[model samples]
Target: MDRKKIVEIISNHYSPLTPECKLDLITNSKLLVLQKGTVLVRGGQFSDKTFFIVNGCARAYYLKDGKDISDWFAFENEFISSINSFFLNIPSPHFIELIEDSVLLEISRGNIEILSNTYHDFERLSKVVAIKTMLKQQERITSMQFHSAEEKYKNLLSIHPDINQRIPLTHIASYINITLETLSRIRKRLTRI
Candidate 1:
């Protein structure tokens, strides 16, 4: 991917960058092309790298009691990181994995700090992105707490209509706290309706 495209994606996702901020990001961020099933950050690893998906998808998930449960997903134009590890300088509790062959822009925590400290625009961009990620987590929690299986499935579909095509159903079921059978039934019922 070219520098201009990366800058455009950053501006579109967060806030517009200054000319200098754009240059700094272009210089600091690394372009990555990774295949499906690449684990960028594993559970218990300290990871300071954050990724912006230029193309394809990734998910942050945890392995609990031998079951894999997804917590978050990022697709084209979205960002994904081991948030706790990235911010708290601790080991990540979840794994970040690419779901498809992906093109990404990776930036280190040190670069983010430098850019945020030096550029007002970068700071604003970071704040905006963090707030957005937090709100998405909140929405997921609310949906899991109050929505019925069918309602949860519908709500997810509303946010990501093509998610079924892009992501595995098992991961989607886990993310919404449903069993695979329940998700299948819901999908069938909705299709008939």
Candidate 2:
């Protein structure tokens, strides 16, 4: 949760930051330690803060009727934010919840605007991060539409093999658009084959 460490991690993702930009981020960002099951962003809430995870994990989900459908997960060294709300200044459609006890560095939207306006490199870095985020979301949507549950599961495992160790089976099943029973069967079959 150290500001220096958080800045260093984020810098690695986009581009090298100027000393002033780093200082501004360090000064504006705040550390939060969230407990498991904590809801950081609720659907329909206006949230302008973005989080950088330093440790542990979180999930973004949408509530349909009474069911919670997980859309994405953020682990250590990942960014988690209500993108629609953060970018458009509207209520969020997703709820972000802490899946494990986590350390996060939070930056407000206003501060991000200031940084982007004052620093050209910061703006470029933000664009790169936004592009990457959009691409990941698009890829997820494509996989969900074109791939079977087992195929999605395998692809997820290939990218994040340790995810099963971090999240519960039920959440993983929901994320991959499969039932818990189906996921269990898939695991059993994979083990046997």
Candidate 3:
């Protein structure tokens, strides 16, 4: 991935980083090409690396009662990490998987800390990322508990307009806290209207 391209993506989320800071970030992070079905972090494992998706998509999910319950998905120019484990230094309750072949910039916790301490811009970016993550979690919890399956599905599309085309129905259903049959019915009903 182009360093400038990645820098531009991050700039969209937080304040623009100085050219020197972007160069430093490029030097500290490693570019990785991951295949679909790749599990970067698994439940009960400790991994503090956060992946910034330069391209493709990934998900964080839990294997609950032998079923994969997707919690969230990240597409191009998004950051996806095992949040609790990465932030709290505990075993992850979820697994991070590449749903599509992905190009990622892997930033380790130590490097992130070093960068944050060294550059004020990185610190600001970290704060913005944390805030966004918290807000997303809050929204998901409230939506799943209060919203109907159709509402939840529609809300998801509002947030990720192209998700239905990119993600599988099973994953979408699970993410919206509905059965696959229900999701199919909702989609069919919406299409007819």
Flag the better candidate by lDDT, 1 or 3: 1
Q: After superposition, how far is residue 50 of candidate 1 from its true place, in Å?
A: 0.7
The 0-to-1 C-alpha lDDT of every candidate, in the order given, reads 0.93, 0.90, 0.90
Q: What are the per-residue Cα lDDT tens digits for candidate 2 across 105-134?
A: 988999989999998878887888788778
User: Which residue pairs show backbone clashes in model 3?
Assistant: none
Give the top-scoring candidate (TM-score). 1
- lDDT for model 3 comes to 0.90
Order the candidates by lDDT, highest first — what do you get? 1, 2, 3
Tens-digit lDDT track of model 1 for 1-193: 7867877888976899988889999999999999999999999999999999999999999999999999998998888999999999999999999999999999999999999999999999999999999999999999989989998889999999999999999999999999999999999988898
Error of 3 at 70 (Å): 0.6
Q: How far off is residue 157 in model 2, in Å?
A: 0.6
In the predicted model 1, the residue pairs found to clash are none
